[model samples]
Target: MMFRKIALTLLTATLGTSGAYAKKAPKFEQAHQLTSEQAALVQKSIGQEKILIKAIQQRTPLVETYIQDTRPDVKLYQIPVGDQYTLSRVDFGKGFFDKTYETKDSANKKGWFKGSLASITGITKALGLDKHFTYNPTGFMQMMFLDPTGFDQQHYVFSYVRREFLGSVRTWVFDVHPKVAGMGRFYGRIWIEDQDGNVVRFNGTYTGPKSEDDSRYYFHFDSWRMNVQPGIWLPVAIYVEESTRDGEKQVGLKAQTHFWGYSLKLPTRDSESVSMKVDDAEDKSEDSTDVSPLQASREWVLQAENNVIDRLEQAGLVAPLTPNGFETTVLDQIVTNLVVPNNIALSLPVHCRIMLTDTVEVTTVGNTILISKGLIDTMPRNEATIASVISMELAHIALGHHIDTRYAFNDRLMFPDESSFRRINMNHNDHDNQEAAAKAQQYLDASMYKDQLSTAGLYWSQLASRGGVLKALNTPKLGDSLLKTDGTPWMATIAHSAPKLNWDDLAQIPALPLGSWLKTDPWDDHVHQLNAKLYAPLNPRDKMPLEVTPVYFRLQRYDEAQSQAANAAAAKPNPGAAAPANPPAAGDPPAQPTGQPTGGTQPPAGTDQPVPSQAEGPQPQQTGGTPNPQQ
Candidate 1:
């Protein structure tokens, strides 16, 4: 689906003479033999992978990929120098078939691609050339599955490493490599759940022919799936990273691809229709006063707002209205905090909703203010920075900057989801932005956040400084970007009084990495605050502002109701049945007590230790990571 125009010479320039830095592929001659019990589980997992593939094909899901091209930095290990982003609903049902041509003979150069490399290369060639080769953003999607065709022992060797726990699930970890080198196979480690034999997570890159430049075709990726249903595990996210050295200079890229909206369907009028009980249904128009001309105009504008919001929700771009959701509980409170203090009265109540994109943008849809998830994710986890962003859109609402009334007509939204950005126009022009920025300053001056404006300015300063490199992250799809096209931030005046940018100041955290504040439910698309612990940064590099990092979930099972129901069903005694005295056979996975992580709350076996970040990586922190204060 990506129409990237890559130059033919880019492969050599970016990767540097392919064979110059290529690492030798691993040999599997000394593979460990699995016991009967371990072999049975391995067999079960292979079958489960096939089932997972079939389940994915039956549903269309939203796929979002964000890439950060990084370069060496003295303070922060690596900072984003450039970026790319793509969001679309991919139909796995149609299937993506890409191949790798790894043979030495030019005529017979062909092998199935392990990742989406072939598709990316094909698209780049078809679209002609550009100065920098832009990869098909969806190329990383192929990392979700091991091998769609030959994933069995006939093609791969699985050596049991140890038993481990990823979140609450118990899994058997194994080292996997392809039996033959030229077939384009997955070379990685996989974690299979002990209970159902599902491959919950896999990490590594694809392998091609020995002589071919594998580095050009593949990058390391860690793909993880969530148990959405009782026995169904769907691919939720994949993190890709590659770091290589060319003498003293280091070059690499980091990307995160997320999938959601699996249950999305075509919009229908009937879906919006509400049926009420006859006794409870009543019209209050009879007791209300007739509408004044002013009221009538407001009503028309409100209609346009509702129509646009409803259409966006149906398209899965906007999260559904949940009563206790982030918008109602967190965002709405922030609006009230600003509105009441400034006495900004309007015809309708100003509310907020989250746009499910990671792009940093904000715009007003009539009285409703929409903020992108990326904007929220990268901000300092404090009220002032968040309030500063919200205040800008609130000013737009108060100033009567609204969406086009043409959207009031339901027929206007009949286009496909892919055409959403093209069809919907909600961005504010320069005049409106200038006026809103001035008005937003006034609102902040009168609000509780006035004193904290200095800290808020720091966040803006960081954003403005990095705006030049992080163009894709700053660009808006449906709203105005925080930064001007020329790399100057709209709120530059607000940040004019802030202190100079200092990397060594451990206490001064301008921003956090993406996904620092919110976590989206893959099934429902609802946004929630991450239940993370807070810790002070140990060094300046710990504050990875606006950079892409690896994804790690606390990893809880989905649908607790289903798990509870199954437990209840199992707890009931069979009629006239007695408990069996016989012990379980050898190699049987030991049963652990309920309500605890699998394997009795003990750490996983082997050298793999629990990561504090998402309980798997280095020390986890709510704000930007700082090194230990004691260090």
Candidate 2:
């Protein structure tokens, strides 16, 4: 679910009082029309929604999110692990339903929030007044408007939007508003597939009650949906972009949420290997030693690389599960673009892997390039920035400054990541590093990315403004710096087209935080696409690039999962209940269900103390977007 707290004083803005310099001055006109068929379809869904919602409340879909809060004061700084944004994150499961909130903010007295324009009180409570931000019982499903009560005529006014094809499905879209402006009412647009009339997507915010002090207002949002089953339209993602005024200043912030693994309980994957007997085995491809000794040795190295990859996957540190499924495809597109233009080819295909960590680094193991999820998240949002990183590695490959065959021993697969770093050496001597950098420069000049290096230069200029903090990102995970040598920047022509970097300039966004553009699964760790919507926060202070948010899952798993959680909570005292207890066996205390607190009079368990689990904390990221460079 998306939460928009930036204040837009529609009451004043509508009165034509704040138009002089208001960024989002004109505002989206609340105008719409619906055909009779569309109205009937919507009514039908509203009546039957409760039943579908009940079923949804039973299953759990994996939830993934990333939030980035950027402002002038939120500069890159050395924070414990490394230089990072004034950022916060949330990564958890159960669609983020029935989840607790956490933050990286340590010093907590009367902290002023940077993004509160609509609801200053709400932000004040979260940052200064409340012990911690908590999810309301209504839960994230509220974001989808599946609750029948929400759509009743007494509360909402609906208007027909248009008939548009979202993908192959033609849909009837509508604008929604609350009869009265209050937190309980939803405001936005909804898309319904013409055939079923099920709400395919809803984009907007709920009406919040007027503040007595007149200090808060609701922020705008865009929610979306996807068909998971034949007749089931599931809410897949929510994007929130809020712009609010803080006194005379305006602020902006961006946030994204994702939901997947809906049919996860049912077997979604099948074995691709064919069943075979001993006879089939005897006719297998070939023996490893069949090739010439030199060729066989190279084959051994390849097999070893595969082994290392498999080990990383099992450890939850590789692509798809790590930086997410997009890494492989992204690497492929880059390689395709570079290889075809530069006429570079290899005997075996090159692969890319991502490590899911906050460390900014990159390295190559055999033909595969390993990039940290953090680096991908922090880099300037441009294809050229990515190409620059890849070119350096490709240069190393071309110059043959590579990992020795020492790791060809499959036994090395058992080594841990830290230990393997010492054994699977991919670093080059300083002299070789310089040669690779020079060669990488030449290769880029001869490739398609060369013309775009001016933008790539802008990236380097920004990175350099971090005053050496970005140098770590330039440093290879296992080798010498790709963009820096010694203490000075090495990409001399990297910023050929961009303006100078200015860290203190609120008008300029120098760099994004880790995971600003990518999201990771809290379950199987698969990464997926966040809705690529844009929100230009009119006020720079409201530009929160990466911030912590309350977890609001699309559904709370109250069916069997609720029973399981209850059984687990009930059995907590007796640590030995083998069978799952239902409805509290005999004399035992009643189990606190998923949404409600066990001890009613008291607040939820983590109200006072922050959640300690990083994986359990609230997460958010900036949406990945950049103008596509012309080839």
Candidate 3:
């Protein structure tokens, strides 16, 4: 056993060294020593003409057959315009798959068209096209040559790779790649017949970005085409298997072997035979053309300005008077401060009009910015909230957010349409960072607009109290549709039961600039019923306290004169009235009641007697008191 192990070790070491030595050896020497026939074969393989001819003879006719045998989820059609044809189809596999087809015609006319399954299905049902379901042979043949771009080159690149025998048919296999980004679905390999270059069988896999339906790949197409007519390739059947990484799969199969009986062709004339030679004539005619660079530059500038205005109008940022003045000012400041100084050429102005809405939304049309009303409404009644909104949008603009060169026209500048937009969700990145927060702090520290910041916070707090609908709309969560989703806050969740202070109590409190007038009232007509139900009862006792109205404070006052008669009446004494008798002193003992009167006046015993006054000056009345002397 030990001897065997040593022998095996030696063998392995020998093999490893030999493999390493071979890899280090020069590869160019072996290539240079190739036989003449082998070199000729290599040259023949890469030649463009041979490849083109093989592709045309093998793949061109199979195109129509492939369409005929396309999965039921995909519909193909031809649109004719002025003797030219445009082919387009809608893939119904995922949520409304949109695709356009373009082709070049023999008459040098370019044809391009788009149609969705919704449109085609309506047409088919309306015209009863489904009743005549038989395959149209002539239509299938014509579809192959309808190139929308007026060019004969195929949209897919094909390279002959190998030859293999499959189920009694010798096949020529080729590798195919899409030449354009939005071309039809791409697969890895295609197999054709070795005898006449007709595609016999094909097997390949397709991969692309994950779709909305969780599709990780576009479609995996495995199909077989046969030569039904001599040297004419046709698709016998096709199969497609779709899947995602999560083990979801949808398999489909389609077959189209028979052809329509009818065929039509346009009348032909022998124009080549009737052509005659004409004498060549040359005339010397020259005209001078003048071009002005200044005029061109002015025109270009005007066009750019017009485009900006149009975009602003569409985004609802520009009005007859406003004309996005705020946005323009912000952009100018940014350009002057950051972009121009840094030598960075801005494709779009660094300005955005952010709509204050419940949810956060940031989008741009040309140089105009559109923010949600909800975002603005939810902000604290202070400048910081405003700064927050502006800074968020400004970050987008400053970072060159809406700049795109993929689409030729500016009309297609949509952030959601961008490839990168799909990669990121609500997460904030370097582009939209904390610049707004920082700027707000800076302004607050500077004390330049302290009141505005406080007001902004109040505003935001009020908005937040109303709920985060504005924030939600502006920063929409997944599945929130613009047209259908109800992003409003629920009444049950809001803290609507505010403290009920009487009007008198409210009035008595020291007044601030805030709540001088009723800011919000439960009984207000504008208040929603749901909101009103949630509000606490308004107290009638709450009164608006009396403050010095400027007008009232400026009024004059007057005093009445004193009267002499009133003073005399007040000084006169009451002569007819008698004073109340005083109580007996505490120290004096009870005095014995005298039966007989003493000294000044006397009365008979046992008789209730009255005292008589002396002198005729004043007379006493029997009623109980003496009459006035004047009477």
Candidate 4:
């Protein structure tokens, strides 16, 4: 797993080192020039960049950045040594400014981002990555824009590469570099969609002024944007990586930054007001019986749950509830599979929601369970593993560990979105978690997943082994950490029985890498299972559980009409196609087998298998969750 040490100078240079610059001499004979049509597209892209900048200024979005510093490891190849995390709601109205959301120490600070000129300086000071030599945090953010002030033919030279397809959008590829040696200039390649001439993706590093080594101050990054609205593209994600000499040692870092909550500023009425008193409205229940004492107590707790969930959603911390969504389709089935077999009866049905962060944590805000996206992404695509995690929160519900009743008062949740982590507390106490853990075991043993406990146990073992290095990732912002205070995972009982860790065992996939299963929609903040070809691991090194990997998006445009048309076309049968065996007649219902309802619901992929392979290989589809409607 040792990375070949590369020269910092060559790693941070412009395309000149690759002969692209050498080919473009004074005579321009070996230069690659853009055709008239391509030149027009480039001009349109320049204007679109300006439009994107202006549009972004009108909205404030949440920006989350996570960094993992790695040194070479003999066994695991490269293991993280240190990590950093920062979450903020950035206001780009007049300049780059942010209100910290994940930390209370700097929650009230107003100077995270000052302006364009000193933006890098503000970010470096805020991130505190280095005190001796500053590494620009804004360098990653600036990847969203080619150049804020100047991004045209006057300042940059564009050479045509070719036409390419990024997901469903066809793009014109071009390599660009600054015309003169200048400070903070973008030198990289861009992918511009052919339809609107908007830059869909850009990858490279920023160049420093003459005589300065850019590698010390800048990092290589790949930034991607999504068509959030018609003719409006916004930055969605950025992946940054750097390997350079820190003193005599070869040190490297990998980081990712995600942006969402674009429509946070849009005006909408409060959801709580929808049930306000209406004229001549009467009770709808036929019995007209008074609510019992038990029902009243439960309703009181439900009030607190509803308040917190609503507030989190409004603050862009939780995804909007969508029917047949990931939670409803995949997670809900897992809950049912556990509850029905255990014969657990509840006064109200349990539900789940995803917290839109890359923290490995889970908690119950009353009966509703909240699991972070990072936890879901890292878990092996096995039903028992996911069920094991969910069963703990389900135990909390059964044990009646309710959220604090104070939150039922609407005024308690009136604080700003930036203070969400500070104001709200949903994590369970140690005693309660211990009790729930024991109860969770009881539920798992009585359920259909009893036989697969060994596989689920391996996940806990893998998590416990990496707990020391991945502290920041495992630390929860709004919920409970899976590990106890002494570093043992809460489900230590399961890990104790798991098969011993064997690095050479390629088939033993303890956990999957981060971003393996779920992807978030930038515009709507919806989480969906990735419809990707799951490949079996070629070696044990391929199973990089809970590690930060490079980000590659299958970029596509947002077109509602085109999407519907495609869906309809897919549903239409071929005229010459042969009929299925015993096709149902017209106007008659399709026959469904007894004991299993047709299309009623299907479990998340791999419910029947006790041990599912979690690897990346080129073959038939592997086990995971159901495909999203937008697929």
Candidate 5:
């Protein structure tokens, strides 16, 4: 919140400094020094805040939001950090609206406050992680802490804590507490830039105030603001970590809220680049680089893949790969174990990638398997359960099912990121889905670990049964299907002995969370599997599938690769990949995928076939497929 506003002259001086001037500038006090002068300066800031607040309110900038709720499993001595329970996670924003590409019940809806808020109480039925309280919602949590009026001197006591440099910005850290302690006031530390005297960052929680309307008010959280424009800092991210324990069973809530697209004219980053240039000169010459037919086919697949990935990264949807060898190795083992037993032939090298999201899904481009981290995080800790997930993508590769390759053309990349999803869809229809599912079952059956399918089958059954409450986790934002019937239960043909039916059972969950098995690169949102041993649940309650829990990351600024990918996905999806089309799950009948399957025991070796121009899904299609296991 904008509490204090510094003089424009001082701000200009601070921003205008060069190398020598910056070093020569006066250093701020490094220790607690709450003198009259400092208080007056803070008061002066408080007086000028109205102007900044008005500026922010008046501009209807496009704001994107992603909110997630998690549940964590704990050990005998360790705190809850075992299996994850992602209660709910929704991604949407205000400004530009494009339900065309959004999932059937995506968190991404229109308006600043129209969509459903992610609250602890709302998810209690799916997998109860809260024993004592609930939250207002994602949006409310963000706005309440950012209440400008709450920052006034009348509400909070501003005493100097210390002066520190967050990178090059010299800041005065103030310990802000309620002058009269009951409610409404924010309790935490605020980092104010010396030059602008503006509150650059606020880290703390709101006083419960304890009202009947909202039984439990707020949880401890950290909110960060970024200076997108000079002298103009706005809230960009928030992290929440809270816990409530009942004896040995402790329920934790880990979540993140992100805001961006703060502009009146919301154009995809790609659109801005497109508007600047128009080349009339057309050189129809083909590439001079020599390549074999099979290589060309593979390149075509990668071309479409690059185009999709480039756009997704720009939109903050696709997170890059973090440095972790274990995840990659696990994927290798799954593929090798499956292919070696099936005697599958392959010319193109198979690769695996990850989507930085909490939605359960598994997809493939060529032989590159793509899965969301959330899928692996919530699954049973075994190779068979994971193999069931990987087999679907493997089936897609073996069956020649994939997204459109037209994006390989340089001309196709001209479109904005908003149109990327619409133009380059990879979701399969109902027919192909069934085929993939059956084939995946066959692949698993032919594997060395066929006996392990029971766990995978149970995993599928649990996922299918919880169809109603786990809507957000089951739905995807873009591609990959997980179920046949949208609202109906989803059951794999490989089902055996599922846990006894209990509508309100908090124990024996089937899945985990995004961070349960993977560590995200806080800088770029990339992900990598953790280097830890996998252990089966000793207790049924230990299986806190898709529960929401607190998430903490070692955050750093975006790097070059992250920046470029974000730029591509930055465009909206008005003209992007196809929205939710077929069921997002595998094991359905052949829903018909792109690049028709070859007739024979195995797929044709690098056939130069015409891939689908576009994957057209049904209206109000489903997002998210089943969780995939890599290793």
Candidate 6:
């Protein structure tokens, strides 16, 4: 429950005020006009009495609130999660009662007295009240509010602080402090209306838990009352403020309440003859109005669809095919085939529109789908690739990938910056769920048009060949740099590592590269170094062109297999390392070196052959003479 403290010290200040003598009873006037010295003594006496009464009252019957038997003009209700996107109003008939009060005067002259109460169901459900809400009264008043009975005589210290005016209300202020240490929760000023000595406002600061640091928490309250009868006042409105801190930052949390519907006993022989009616009601009241859950769901879907479509067009994904081109082609196709069918399948309806943007990406805002020209350009020259991207995004929407109740009604769902997009990933568990989704996507992709499936595979192969930004999929912890659209380290890496192919080969392909439609930085130190170190080792025969593989496809497993084969080829033993086991050709001398040709004079030209060296054992030679050692 929301807590609001009404200062009691101010009540004493109001009653202690001095005024001109009147014909009132001498005892009453004398009691009201105490000399300065007498005032101090009387305050001590009253303070002690109050402490005693509070202790005794601690065990007495605590008041229970009941709704007055009357109709209320307005009501407020909290929306449940899941359906929070649609704020529906619920009305619980006018014949209802809410809070009740005890009578102070049988004649109904003085205001009805009641302790304050507050309903926190909405906040409790939304954030779990126990986790987020705490009562932090100031230091001097802590014991008084919490213990209710642990008051020592030395703790009864009250001092007249001041007299001031708040809004249209004149009040007398006073300070109440604990005479002894560790006796209370608050040390601050309170203001009371002079007319009837009722608390009207209070402001104070509270210290933290006794064992923690002595940091102060500030609080304030203002109460407005209606004159229910002559010389009587009853509270009709209250506003409270409490300080909240997050790390080093602090902010104020404010709450307000308006009371209506009052009941009073009638002057009848039977005390049971009591009546109630709306109290000080206003023309405009906040009341709950009911709405159908199904209708609310439909509205949310429609909103999502609109939001996505708007973002797509703004990004220039869909062709702005003239005035009606968007409606006639892209939007029409989506409504007929995608949105309508999906709505029927899910038992949820949606209204969707498509927009064309120049970006090479597809993203969603609510139910709205955005497709970009760059995305189109990157696709293989076929319908399959287009379907693949669209279907993937559609799956995300159908599964509520990016839906957030907090931001359901927000129109600015598009990524404001890279940081925000990163936050989205951090908030969602997309990767953990992707494997399961992929399995399902495979079937969906196959069941769709054959052309779409064929184009999808072609797109995948093309992107695999091109080691552009998509190459990040192959390396762990390397893709973040490649996702940047700006010409930075990521873009440079994509450009340097992209597979190269002859112009003739590219021309023969049906699909062509979109060029650098999205500009990126050319200078990347890591990219340059990696390229320099790797270029010489890559075999021309094993090299694949950049345009053959789809970036989003899972091809790393295949790439790893190919890399293992290449490594094995490089590590294989060389067959030529050992010496040949063959004898020298005809005319070759048996002994060579310094005594070469000693036994046999000179060998004929082209016929001379030397004996094979020990390193090169006897082996057959293709030529007549010994083959050159190098050969």
In candidate 4, where is summed lDDT lowest over 10 consecutive residues? Answer: 611-620
Per-candidate TM-scores read 0.79, 0.48, 0.23, 0.80, 0.54, 0.27
Put down candidate 4 lDDT per residue, 1-631, tens digits, no spaces.
1223333333232464555432322311233778999999999999998899889988767677787888876777787787766655556775743321111112222322444333223322332322433233444565566687778999888999999999878999998888776666678889999988999999987665542225544567899998877778899999988776666777888989998888876323344355556799887789666877776777788788888887778767788754445675567557766665665655565677899888889999876889998899888878788889999998998798878988888767763522333567799999999999999999889877889899899999999898888877887778899999778999888888899988888778888887887787776787766758877777666777788889987776678534953584466432222122232211122233233311112222211222111121111111135322122
Is candidate 1 or 6 superior in TM-score?
Answer: 1
* Candidates, ranked, TM-score: 4, 1, 5, 2, 6, 3
Candidate 2 vs candidate 5, lDDT winner: 5
Where model 1 places Cα greater than 4 Å from the true spot, the runs are 1-26, 97-133, 211-213, 246-248, 266-279, 417-421, 559-631
RMSD of 6: 35.5
Q: What overall lDDT, based on C-alpha atoms, would model 1 receive against the true structure? A: 0.70
What TM-score would you give candidate 2 relative to the actual structure? 0.48
Q: Write the per-residue lDDT of candidate 6 for residues 1-631, one digit (tens) a residue.
A: 1222332231212243575333322111111333475345434434443443333232211110110111111221111011000000111111112222111112212111112111112112221222322232111111113123332234434456566775445666665444333412334545555544544343444322331113332234343433333333333333444443444433333333322222211112232234879889776545745557754765565454444333323322222222222222232233223322222132222222222211234454444344443344444333334444555555655566644443444333342222322222202234523532453254333443333343344444444443343322211110011122222221122223333433333322323333111111111100000001112112222222222211111111223434753674366332222111221211122223342211111111121144223233222111111111112
User: How much is the lDDT of residue 190 in candidate 2?
Assistant: 72
**Candidate 2 residue runs with Cα over 4 Å from true position:** 1-39, 47-185, 207-219, 228-232, 258-347, 352-365, 370-387, 396-439, 445-459, 462-493, 496-631
lDDT of 2 by residue, 64-119 (tens): 33333322233432121122211111111223222221221222222112221122
lDDT of each: 0.70, 0.47, 0.28, 0.70, 0.51, 0.30
lDDT of 1 by residue, 1-631 (tens): 1111122242222355554553443455468999999999999999998998888777767777788988888777888889877666655665544555333212212333323233223212221211143554445677778887778999889899999888878889999988777545888899998888999999987775552225656677899999876678898999998877655667788999988887776445566565867877789988987777766776677788888887777767888654344564456556655765565555555667888888888999987889989998888866777788988898988788878988877666653522333567889999999898889999888887788888889889999999999988897877899987777778776787578879888878888889887777677777765657767788887888898999986555666635753574366332212112221111122233232221101111111222122133111111112122223
TM match of model 6 to true structure: 0.27
CA RMSD of each candidate after superposition: 15.1, 19.9, 42.9, 9.9, 16.1, 35.5
lDDT of 5 at 401: 83
- lDDT score, candidate 5, position 389: 80
- Return model 5's CA RMSD, one decimal: 16.1
Superposed by TM-score, candidate 6 places the C-alpha of residue 403 at a distance from the truth, in angstroms, of: 2.8
